[model samples]
Target: MVSTGLEDLEQSFSSQIRNGWNARPVFVPAEFAGMRGRLGVHDVVMTVERSTGRGFESITVASIQTDEGTGRGDAATSTAEAPHDRVSLTVIGLPELGSPLPIIGIDMIALKGTLSLVALDLAPTSTSFWDDVCEKRLFALAEDARDRLVIRKRPEFAHETFSRHAIIAAARPGCEEHAFAIARNFFTLATDVVAAAMGRVGDDPIEARNRNLAWRRSERQNRKEMNALARMFGEDRARTFIDAFLFA
Candidate 1:
């Protein structure tokens, strides 16, 4: 069984989003609609490495979904399941930021099953506001996925699995500020959860130290980029935008 506790899972996902957003170009002149329309559907393949000398293992052909629709409530919710037709691959690579690198690619798959809710959360939504909400939800799903993957080395999440198989379900779209709040709450919660779990499970001192080192290195790199962004857009505005999109 994989050793992903809920806390670790959440932390891993939160870290991924933080890095992805922070590393992205400061200004994407493209309008939200353009970005949404260009969204790609893909399959996720995840590879996990165990700290306990358990070696490494992977799962392939997982589904990913993205929806960027204009509807405020109903329409936003309805499109959440749109990525069911594609398969995604997530490769674990050398530490890029504070977490493993996910080299993502997508493919179309003929065999259909309900997408694991955890995977569906990674989908893009219609606007920044909706994206923020979905980002928080996705972190939740990531937490669940980490746990299941650690224990089973495969996707698990009864609710998500069922949702994938059933008629499509919609996620509530929220205002940008509200969505940002949700993502922030999830990040804090997930961080706490993982820290507690790590404390309980205990970790190899060497590995822990190494991870801390990697995190610090990543932090330095992020700070440099953040500084550059601050210069491009006034510091205050840059910070505000970064805070908003970091999780979205």
Candidate 2:
């Protein structure tokens, strides 16, 4: 297996989540761990990790890497001149049953030699949370990243799922470091949001839960991602994994 530099970045983000949240492993099926197999003419590797902490309901990170690489087919998502070899996706799900905090998400795709895309967001559950908890810090980070990188348009569902301050951008050859820093900064800010939500009162729990459910429904409707996963894995497995790890 070759390194697309995503491995290190994924490790860094996972470590931060573990330490900052005092997270403990959530049960994962054996098949989702250290899985190696063949997909078409290319060898494939994939992993899924899930954890839960005091204030968080669940946190999930998953990665998919293909030897021959794959194109996302959206130029806005990937400005790389070539296909990408690895993708790292993370979602830090807040406890929607209690707190109306935003869900933190980051997705990164790396070409064979360089980064192609980095999309980071604190997906808001309510307008008040967006304004009070996320607006200022998130926009500051987004603006800084935007100043250095080429901003990309979100997919249709993402436009509905992500907050206004979401940073969806492509980091060209020389801008990988800036993109990584922005991702890290967003993760840090997300942890701070979690800390602030501890013991903090929120709006109606029923409303918060319903909003999060709506967000997950929209996210799961992403056809491109679902189609790609179905192609590599079976449709049933893909759907199961999506429901279990990616959005659950």
Candidate 3:
């Protein structure tokens, strides 16, 4: 009984990302909130990007289709029924803004107890994207192994998890700008989402603030695409804002 489609979602999201007026943080990058609990949505939502085959661009937030509660937990990726009670957030964006079809982007989703799905958007946005995608499989497998083990608190999990979380943290603000057409940064929306959700649920702010500090420090830099920007403004001046990816 799905009444909405990608066009509807895209138009809705593009206009107001994660940091929109009604979004978390009160102001910032593009992000999607359920909006007073699913933005008045009563049905399970599934939105797909029109131009990309990358699974990250699309989002499905609802209960797990099935339950894989028990597994080796060896970094193996298995899809089950979406977690019914837990919030699942997915942030998707192109490899570079305005890139054509076959979009390359990252998708980060959190499950009830752990990440049911996580991966870097490592494909080129072009007809030849498949070749890049093929090269990424092995890399992804290895990375997943580390991620799964890290989730379990195995060895070196702390450092890797920090690094991994940093990347995920970066995704939110990154996508915010991509969708809103602004200078981009990373992790702002992600942090704000968690903070808002915690505050909404009455989680301890001190504890949340403590964790956010580490997550904040874990933050790192990202792609600074500004060639077109340079053309708009003078090169010398635009270079100063190369890091500037968002406007509002």
Best by lDDT: 2
TM-score of each: 0.24, 0.82, 0.24
| lDDT score for residue 178 of model 1 | 26
Tens-place lDDT per residue, model 1, 1-248, is: 01112223334543543353222212332321111121223222222211110111111121222332322544433323333222122211112222221111111111122222122222111123223333454455445434332212222222321112111121122222222233344444423322323313222434433443433333234453356435433466445433433211
Off by over 4 Å in 1: 1-174, 191-201, 229-248
Greater-lDDT candidate between 2 and 3: 2
Name the regions of candidate 3 deviating beyond 4 angstroms.
1-34, 38-86, 95-102, 127-248
- The C-alpha stretches of model 2 lying farther than 4 A from their native spots are 1-5, 37-41, 66-87, 111-113
lDDT of 3 by residue, 1-248 (tens): 00112123334443344335232222222221211112111112322222221222222221111122332344323321232322233333322222222222233333222342333322222323223322344244334344432223312322522322222222232232222221111223322322322212212334333433332222222222234224323455434422322210
Give the CA lDDT, 0 to 100, for residue 129 in model 3.
29
- Clashing residue pairs found in predicted model 2: none
